[model samples]
Target chain A: MRAVGEGAGGPKSLPLILARELAANLATPMFLIDAGGTLVYYNDAAEGLIGRSFGEQGEISAGQFGEMLQLTEPDGTPVRRRDTPAGVAFFQRCPSHRVLQATGYDGVRRTVEVTAYPLFGTTDEMHGVVTVFWETGG
Target chain B: MDVGVWGCRGSLAAPGPETIRYGGNTSCLDVVLSSGHHLILDAGTGMRPLGVMLDNAGVDEVHVLLTHLHLDHLQGLGFFRPLFRPGVAVHVWGPASPVQSLSDRIAIYLSPPLFPVRLADIPSDVTFHDEPLEAVAIGSATVRAAKVTHQGPTVGYRIEEGGASLVYLPDHEPSLGVTLANHPADWTSGYELACDADVLLHDAQYGDDEYPRHVGWGHSCVEHVVDFAAKANVGNVVLFHHDPYHDDDDLEHLLVQARARWTSAPERVRLACEGMTITLDANGVAFGAQAARA
Candidate 1:
């Protein structure tokens, strides 16, 4: 589609596009969740971490995500989705990551620190959040 | 690539008469480049002796790099006299912690149940920098860090200067199934961290037979060390993190077995000892007194 001269020629939408590229380039696992705590956007690292594509599945509940990652405590007890850091962060509207370890397998026991923060809209309304994690518990 | 191992041990500080032969201190290494900049890796119990050496030598500002927050790497920090003295600034660098920064990690090691003195109580001007693993520019040397196969969020260092590179992977487990299955390309195949350096100081806490039983214990066998060095094409491989039960004679036997691999394809390999110093030239290759310094 051909665009008008001013709209096509000007540096329109450059900053927005650059910001989106920068977010995609992050090395750590990053996933965005909606106000209802449903998975929305997951970067490449987040995909590798979960061993599957959160984007392909679309909306993933906090409980389902925790089960997929085999989330556990330092003592190796299964982490309840309700009590999971992501759930808590979502409900409490804050950032949190608890009990991390390095492990292999999707839905198998591994050490990792999980975190969640509330996303906000421009009008100060709740929009979505991002969760990230890494290996721990040596 | 000019590399040296000042101190290497595991678990706790093994300072005693029995350990005197191997210098019973913990982890520490002094890497010097042709530029005269010194980078001290880990401040384990070995730092006590290192501090004395540097203080007597009139080193004003020494740079310390830490791999993790384990106590063994930090126990000797208080004993390092330079921290208690004024005008001697110790610039410390470590991996970024999820809970706290590098300075906060050091503070946790000091004071109360951990130790008597607080890190803040230390008189020296100390600056802690927590950054990602990469080629970091310090004083006159370029220090690089590679995340290694360890239990926690740990990393191995590759300190280079004057063209010489020393690879330090003190606490790595070669057969980490989890790390391999997850980041197969990085950890499993061989050591991604210690490849093709002038000197590779690696964890060799177990013998060949003992490694299987200690799987997932976060340690390596002598065989793993030899294999990794050969695979990486490292110049000189130094067996580090020796088990306390294995005395110098036992280590020598292990060295014999390790050196035999080189018979078919010669590789410079040896066991690290206390007070061992390997001087490198402008080329970043070790020269003069190739073996452990006595």
Candidate 2:
């Protein structure tokens, strides 16, 4: 994995640095989810946002991760990883962004506007997705 | 045209730093018409800035339209500078619901318990016009109102002139029931309310997932906004009523999503931000940050 990320930066992983750089300055909750919508990377805001420690949750898949977040659409529909705004953005080839209510572990629901962008590798193959989640209001 | 939110709070003011960026002022929108006519959507706290703007411009005659008498919509009339100008004539329009006159409705808020002054103390020559949703002409433009979805009685306006139209329906919910089934083919659904208008400033206070929790809250979801924009065939659809929690970066992301989903021929969809000005002509639409001094 480190070799895949290293170019000329010695032993440092380029992809990890890229992810860190992307998530560093965001004031809102941001994360990088795999094509399966699994939890791969999360920012500091994500910790405070969903009320759960990211890495300690074990290797959770997208669907399982959504369950932990208690995610559901306004119409009482399930939010599968493939159907998440981020998921939809990737497969559907259209950006999916909207203000959504996400229920945390404590059952507290916060209004979030989520934006998802699809990422591709050098071979023009799909890699994963970068999702930025913003808590509504200042 | 230039649109400044001024007030974004609903029902009443939620004054605090948390509500400041998007504004805690109620639902006042200052729309500068192409003909330079100053149109005030509501007198919410947001109107204070507009009042100051008009004061500096020495603007006298102004047209003020009230959607309803919800406190947030009229709270700032007390602070509006133009209302006290000696030679200024302010025309107020509101729905002729079962409530008292428009002036009487606004007076309740200005009275002793709410504030020290009375509505009559204002020096401007104020005239109130009450009627059902009907067309009223201003200069060469036509401003018409239509009943909308809300708790108390409410109405939305459509302003058209010089082959350009701008629809203001600040307090509305996107649903297929009461409001949609009643209107004609042109103004029935959110799409109809916006059909071919140069700009449709519709209420998109929540996201699709937030709709269930906020059903009947008199606001639409971003998805519905995109849906309406696509179906209405409008030039551009601006998502108004920013959720108090969303910041500049969050709004930018939402605009990206709206643009991605928009499939109109000459597509236009964006989030409404303070100081954002939109210019429309026969060719297309253009957006820019309004000069701060303007």
For model 1, give the TM-score of chain B: 0.88
lDDT of 1 by residue, B105-213 (tens): 7788788787898888888999987633447787666777754556665667877666666778888775544322233222242354566678888888888888879
TM-scores, one per candidate: 0.64, 0.61
Q: What tens digits encode model 2's per-residue C-alpha lDDT throughout A26-68?
A: 7678876554445566777887887776555534565666666
Off by over 4 Å in 1: A1-138, B1-4, B15-20, B178-190, B265-267, B287-294
| TM-score of only chain B in every candidate structure | 0.88, 0.86
lDDT (10s digit) by residue, model 2, range B1-294: 455556655556656655544445567777776667777888877788879989999988888888877777787888899888899989988866443666787788878989888878878898888732447776556788765556566777887766778887777764533233232233233344467888888777776667779876777777667766656667778777666556545556666766776754424676665556666555556777656633
Q: Candidate 1's interface RMSD, please?
A: 16.6
Lowest summed lDDT window (length 10), candidate 2 chain B: B178-187
